[model samples]
Target: MESKTGTTRRDLLRAAGLGLTFPLLSACGGLAGGGNSSKNQAKSALKIGFVSPRTGAAAGFGEPDAYVLDLAKKSLTSLTVNGTEYAVQILDRDSQSNPQRSAQVANDLINSDQVDLMLTTSTPETVNPVSDACEAAGVPCVSTVVPWEAWYFGRGAKPDQKDAYKFTYHFCFGVDQFHNMYTHEWPQVPTNKKVGVMWPNDSDGNAIRAALGPLLKQSGYTIVDPGAYTDGTNDFSAQIAKFKAEDCQIFNAFPIPPDFATFWRQAAQQGYVPKIAQIAKTGLFPSQVEALGDIGIGIAGGAYWTPTFPYKSSLTGVDSKALGDGYQATGKQWNQQLGPSLALFDVAAAVLKAAGNPKDKLGVANAMKTLSVDTPIGKLEWGKGPNANVVATPILGGQWIKSTDPKYKVDFVLVENSSDPNVPVAAKLQEYKP
Candidate 1:
């Protein structure tokens, strides 16, 4: 967990398939401010548990999240709240994208590790149980990647149940936001182009499909029967063939990393190049594009942050170039720049500042409820009105611009910069498919 002087060493390790590991409390000693009673410490060190998929099909996204958490934790040592020093202890567990395993990890983090707060980016199936555990324990949990709608309205209601979850907070945009962006902006896209969507058969996929139905109807586009793939399936040739049969002009894929890479590569191999290709989650990380090589060229999707975007906030001083450079200096190639992680950390900082003490979970949750801080993305305030879940925040979008510079050897474009979460759908969906 030692911070490298530059990102180069870490990048080399990541490229070599050697994942980074955080130092355990026993090994790090008092460096991370652990092993001391809250009363003995000037400001209690907050132990924030993170349950993310580190060694699963979504590792491309999960790994960067873990790295971002590490960076955030290191950054916190230098942060001061009202001139009082504070520290952070990040307890990380890999969910492996399995619901049962994720539940075990959740229970351990909450009941055994006694974590003050927890952060998650699990898929819908895995997230529900964990959210239930946190809610029952009265622990504050923040999820950066879980679709907001699923958490707000439980997966199809049972015969006799209300659809709502009270304890989980969503910090990222929901599927409705992304779907609205596309549907509202369809008028801007040339008419008569066939739209082929390939979404996973899960809660995330269902949500997108539910939103797409009304949007496509309103936009006057012929929706080719979308193809559905199981979450971990590799072969997409049959699905691609269906799009080819429909003479698909635009392709929208919502699969995770390796599958996304496989689909894009196969599409190119089969000469199935759409006029414009759009991917949902693939563009979020740089590694996904890197894994696909030239196959990912011209692909557009919404992302949280990128190097080209302006950071219009006092929290980070508004210089995105320096942040990108610092990330590059770590020896890691700046691909999917860590947008959500940075924003989440800023939120964590706000929570700590408001609580005035890290050991108080209830006090921290109350403080979070009142916080309205400006972040690198934009000003974020907890949703406080009646019927508000209190754990979710607005989402912004960015594009991936292809970079050819040898200094930055990556081919992805972040054309659309991150905007405020509430940007009108028409404005947010400005087409970048060309």
Candidate 2:
């Protein structure tokens, strides 16, 4: 729950219920009574609010956030707009990995702190709610980490719709990108094409079930879905039995971290190991896999970002390896969320600077629509994507390998890069030997 500003989001919640809501209201209320001069002087610095799930079930996404935020603040401390030097103030808030809390903090950022721009990350749990708040409040927002379809259609935007939400823009891979990765990697493992799926009755799971399921089925694969289970479910014995009975040798799931850990352990104990456990959502981070011990080896997952990616940060010009090295140097583990998290700031800086007026929310949001900038995850082109406000990043396919390498406990090696060939393949896809 720690933040780069020396204060945690939990501290704000404790000091004032719902993240300084009452106090912020009172303070802003008093500010409204001030003369025009005082109000104008308040615009001396540009305020940006960054929200993420720093705690709860998805806390791993925020482990290196504090460090990244500190780096962002140092590099983007000041910028000139219209010949005026403006100091930048970034207020970080924790979503607690809950949708309600995500919206509440975003509201406070837009209305209370008067942030000109908003940035949110992690998953649908945090991104959807924060995007809702920003879109409703007419604040320019940029988000990453979540799938594009989950963030777009999960919020009720229909397929092929352009500019469905004008104020909010998202940059990440969608189900199509995942489909490409899965189809490319699954064949290498040599399965019976009967894939077992765990589709929870949630945004990410549902979206994958509806979209990815059909894609696989169209490609002549038999899908064995055990109905939709809820997140945080403890027992997966029934689901394992169904997959075992069907003799399904390939498994895939887009679930939260803890649920995957629980189900995988149960599946192993039940002797229902699949040839390729092409899991998503979870298994992107090292700690999640390390928790599974030897069972974690050869577990295939989609890679959104990796240290070996051939890209550099637009803000700092630090390449993928350098960024990962700097993070590992902090005595912390390397994660896939690092590149996209930093890309959020890179896009923020470009959007605000291109706006010509940093204080004008509408101007900045408009600039983001046509903006294309080179990020750590490669070039994010808003105009070239399926949606006007959505820029699809590459979704590489990789597997977690249990290694004796001194640097990593479980190393993720790239296997497929159909979306972006610039990302090199580090290893060939291997069958799970469980």
Instruction: Quantify all predictions' global Cα lDDT against the true fold.
Output: 0.62, 0.88
Could you give me the TM-score of model 1 versus the true structure?
0.75
What is the C-alpha lDDT profile of model 1 across 1-434, one tens digit per residue? 34333334455456446443223321334234444443456344567777777777666566566546666666665446666665667788888877788889999999888888777774665566677678788887766666665555544333233324444555656655666555533444564567888877777776667666567656676777645678778777887898888888777776766677777778778878776577776666666666666665456676555555456434454445555666777777664436555666677667767777656777776676557766555566665522345334433443345666766535444332223433322222334342
Per-model tally of clashing residue pairs: 20, 0
The list of candidate 2 runs beyond 4 A from truth reads 1-37
What is candidate 2's lDDT per residue for 248-361, written digit by digit as tens? 998989888889999999998989988888888888889888889999999998888888888988887888898888998998778888899999989988988899998988
- Model 2, position 20: C-alpha lDDT score: 64
Candidate 1 regions with alpha-carbon error over 4 angstroms: 1-45, 65-67, 78-87, 122-129, 154-165, 183-191, 312-319, 356-358, 384-387, 390-402, 414-434
Alpha-carbon lDDT of model 2: 0.88
